[model samples]
Target: MQILLVGAGLSGAVIGRKLAEAGHSCRIIDARSHIGGNCHTERDADTGVMMHVYGPHIFHTDDQEVWNYVNGFAEFLPFQNRVKSTTQGAVYSLPINLLTINQFFGKTMRPDEARDFIAGQADRTIEDPQNFEEQALRFVGRDLYEAFFKGYTEKQWGCAPTELPASILKRLPVRFNYDDNYFFHRFQGMPKDGYTPMIAAIMDHPNITVQLDTPYSADMTATVDHVFWSGPLDGFFGYDLGRLGYRTLDFERFTHDGDYQGCAVMNYGDRDVPWTRITEHKHFSPWEIHDGSVCYREYSRAAGPQDIPYYPIRLVKEKALLADYIARARATEGVTFVGRLGTYRYLDMDVTIREAMDTADAFLNCARRGTAPPAFVTSPD
Candidate 1:
């Protein structure tokens, strides 16, 4: 079978590799002039730093299979994302750990004491929090919420915390212990050479052909047996229903002779700060040393048609339109929508790879049985 993959990112690369190994011919194409999508990285000729072109992508996952799958392509270097935040004229540890709790209130409380103290600080009046603001206030009370979350949440989502859903805040945890590691995954690392090489290695099979800077045309599908689309779900339908809301980021890059922020990521919790976070690219590859540093001050805003869509805003308005697109995709034949953009959801790199592998498995099984493959392996909802 001849397969047409609509995006040259991890989703297309993984699925294409799997199908190609099974004696299927795969042609992968991307609108951008490169592979790896947002995970694209390049070396800074001046600073000799591996600059995360779009943004920082740290590979962290509990799935051992996914971990092994990526390591097969590129050397994996140990990297734990320890995030920091600045607000109210002081720098503090993120995820609200014991240190942050004690320092913010100026109390030297132990783990158990801190936990109890935070519990007392919480607003017990709101038993069931409805929105982001209520949830944060109920969990950490006014002071901590305002200092660490309120302003940052408002800036990141481009709206007041009161308007955002509670589930967004639920993803973050206030730890009683001093474990400042951002993710709780068993396996966490960065690609030694960067994500582009890993993705290029994945698509290097003899049966696979890659075309960069190739926009998806309706006529291309006529030549292929099946289509795996990793582009935006609304885009495939010409966005007739309406465009799904997305948050795009604007990165302001600058170079520093020495260490800039002394960390990989430094988030600004004060809404008045304007930018959400500053990422030091040199810190991302601590294994390699360079005198100069490259960093990006990230600013988030509502995505325009011309902007590169980053975070999917699945607010009430977008959900209704997403349902329509999902239904239309199901009715369409010979096409499978895969990956983050295809489903219009914010997906981590690990989840994206896992789903792509599973999608390939399902496709191969269906082919053997002479049956139609699913339009979506995982439900968007």
Candidate 2:
């Protein structure tokens, strides 16, 4: 089978590699002159630090097979994302752990004491929370919500917390203990040589041909047996119905002679602070020593047509538009939408790769059984 993969990111690379290994000819193309998509990384010429070109991407997963699959391509270096937040003129550990709780309140409470104290602070009157603000107030109380969540959430989403869904706050955990680790995953690490090389290695098979700086067009799909699209779902249809809402990030990059902020990520939770977070690139790879430092002050805003979409603003309005695109995609034939942009959902690297592998498996099975492959292996919703 001749497969055409649009966008040479993780999804396309993984799916192309799998199909190529299964005796299919795969051609992967990307509009950008790189392979790894948002996870693209490159060395800073002067600093010698491996900079995450599009912000930071720390690979962390609970799935053993997904871990093994990435490890097969590149050497995985042990990395635990310990995020920090700078709000109200002081620094605190992320996930609102016990330490953070104690520090913010200026109280030396034990685990049980802190739990009870927070429970007391929480608003039990609101039994059913409707919005992000209501959810935060219900779980963590007013002070913590205003200090840590309200401003940050408003800036990140470009709306008041009250406008956002309560489900967003549900993803964030308020730990009773001092486990400041951002993610609760079994496997967490960074690729020794960065993600670009790993993705290149994945697409290194003889049956796979990668062409960078090549954008996908309607004509290109004519000769291919199947199309695996990792680009924007709305873009596939030229955004006829309407554009789905998305939040794009703007990074204000600066260089320093030595250590900049002493951490990988320092989020600004205060509404007064224009930028959301500042990422020190050198801190990402702590194993290597670098005298020079590169940092990015990231700012989030509504995505424009030319801007790179980072986070999907999946509000009620966007969901309605997304449904229309999904319906149109379902009606179309010989195309399988894969990855974050293809499905119009925020996806982690592991989940993206896992879905790509599963999509390939399903396609191979469909080929064997003389059946049609699905438009989506995983639903965007």
Candidate 3:
């Protein structure tokens, strides 16, 4: 079978590799010159630091299967994402941990004491929280929300927290303990050689032919037995219904002597601060020693046609638009939609890879039985 895997990111690369290994030929096409899509990483020519081209992507997942699978491609170094935030005039640890709580309140409270204090601060009147604001008020109360989340959320999403869904804030943790690790995943690490080489390694197979700087078209779909699209859901259809809402990121790069931020990610919670966060690229790979450091001041905004879509703004309005695209995708034959952009969801790296592997398995099974694979292994809805 001659399979066409569009978008040479993790989804397409993983699925294409699987199909190719199973004696099926794959022609993977990517619009960008590079293969890793948004997760593309390369070493800085001047500083020799491994720079995350799109943004900082820390590979953290509880799935051992997914963890082991990625390890096959590149060596992963132990990296814990300890994020710091600047608000008002002081710098504090993220996730509102006990340290942050004590620092913010000027009190040395233990885990139990801090937990009770936070509980007392929480709004007990709001029985059922609706939006992000209500959820924050109910969980961590107004003080922490306003100090850390409010301004940051406003700048990040370009909307009021009251308008956003509770699920958005639900993912964030309010730790009572002093553990300041951003993610609570069992397995957390980064690719030693960066994501680009790892993805290239994954796509390196005899039967797989990757065509970089090539965009997939509806006309080209006729040439292949099946088409697995990992591009934007609305983009596949030329946005005939309407463009789905997406928040893109603009990075301002700057090099510095020695250390700049001292941390990998320093989030600016103050609304006055134009950029949301500044990431020191060298800190991402702590193992590598460099005299000079590279950093990026990230700014988020509504994705334009030319901009690379980062986060899908799946608000009520965009969900309706996505539903129409999902319907169109389901009806389209010889096409399987996979990954973040294809499904219009904010997916972590592990979830994307797991879904892609499952998609490939389903496709191979269907081929063996002389049947057609479904449009989506995991439903967008």
Candidate 4:
């Protein structure tokens, strides 16, 4: 079978590799000059730091199989994402941990005491929260919500928390313990060399052909048995219904003589701060030391047609448009929508890879059974 894998990110690379290994001819095309999509990384020539060109992407996953599969391509160094945030001229650990709670309130309360105190602070009137603001107020109370989440969420998504869905705040855990680790995952690390190399290795199979700087068009679908699209779902249909809401990032890069921020990520939770976070590239790979450092001050805004879409703002309107796209996609033949953009959801790296592997397996199984593969291995809705 001749398979056309669109977008040479992890989703395309993994699926392409799997199909090629199964004796199918796979051609992976990416609009960018490189692979790895948003996870693309490169060594800073001036500072010798492995720069996450897009932003910081720490690979943390509870799935051991996905971890091992990625490790097969490149060595993953042990890395914990200890995130910090600044607000009102004070620095605090993220996820609103015990330390942050204690520091913010200037109280030496234990975990149980903190939990009880926060419970008291939490608004009991709202039994069932409908939006992000209500969820935050119910979960962590007014002070913590305003300090840690409100401004940050507004800047990140470019909208008031009240307008956003509760599901967004539900993803972030509010810890009563002193554990400052951002993610609660079994496996957490970054590729030793970089994501580009790892993705390159994934697509290096004998039966796979990679075409960088090549955009896959709907016309190209005629030449392949199947198409695995990792690009935007609305883009596949030329956004006939309407453009889905997405937030894109802009990085203002600069060089420093030595340590900058002294951490991999430092977010500015205060609305006064223009940029969302400042990332020091050297700190991401603590194994290597450099005399100078490269850093980026990231700014977030609504994604334009030319901009690379980062976070999918699946509000009510976008969801309606997405439903229309999904219906059109399902009715169409010879194409399987996979990954974050295809599914139009904010997905972590592990979920993307796991879904890609499952999609590949499903396609292979369908091929063996002489049946048509489903339009979606995982439903967008």
Candidate 3 lDDT tens digits, 1-381:
999999999999999999999999999999888889889999999999999999999999999999999999999999999999999999999878999999999999998999899999889898888999999899888899899999999999999999999987655358888899999899999999899999999999999999988977778987889999999999999999999999999999999999998999999999999999999999999998999999999999999998899999989999898889999998999999999999998899999999999999999999999998999999989
* Steric clash count of candidate 4: 0
Residue 75's C-alpha lDDT in candidate 1? 97
**Where's the lowest-lDDT run of ten residues in candidate 4?**
167-176
Model 1 Cα lDDT, one tens digit per residue, 1-381: 999999999999999999999999999999999998998989999999998999999999999999999999999999999999999999999878999998889999999999899888889899899999999888888899999888988888899899899998765369989999998899999999989999999999999999998999999989999999999999999989899999999999999999999999999999899999999999999899999999999999999999999999999999999999999999999999999999988899999999999999999999999999999999898
Q: Which of 2 and 4 is the better model by TM-score?
A: 2
lDDT of 4 by residue, 1-381 (tens): 999999999999999999999999999999999889999999888778899999998999999999999999999999999999999899999878999989999999999999899998898898899999999888889998889889998899998999998877764357888999888999999899989999999999999999999987778988999999999999999988889999999999999998879889999999989999999999989999899999999999999999999999889898888889999999999999999999998899999999999999999999999999999999988
Model 3 residue 208 CA deviation in Å: 0.4
Model 3 score (lDDT): 0.93
Per-residue lDDT of 131 in model 4: 96
TM-score of candidate 4 to 2 decimals:
0.98
TM-score of 2: 0.99
Residue 282 of model 4 has an lDDT of 90
Q: Native-vs-model 1 lDDT? A: 0.93
lDDT of each: 0.93, 0.93, 0.93, 0.92
Number of clashing residue pairs, candidate 3: 0
Model 3, which residues run further than 4 Å from truth? none
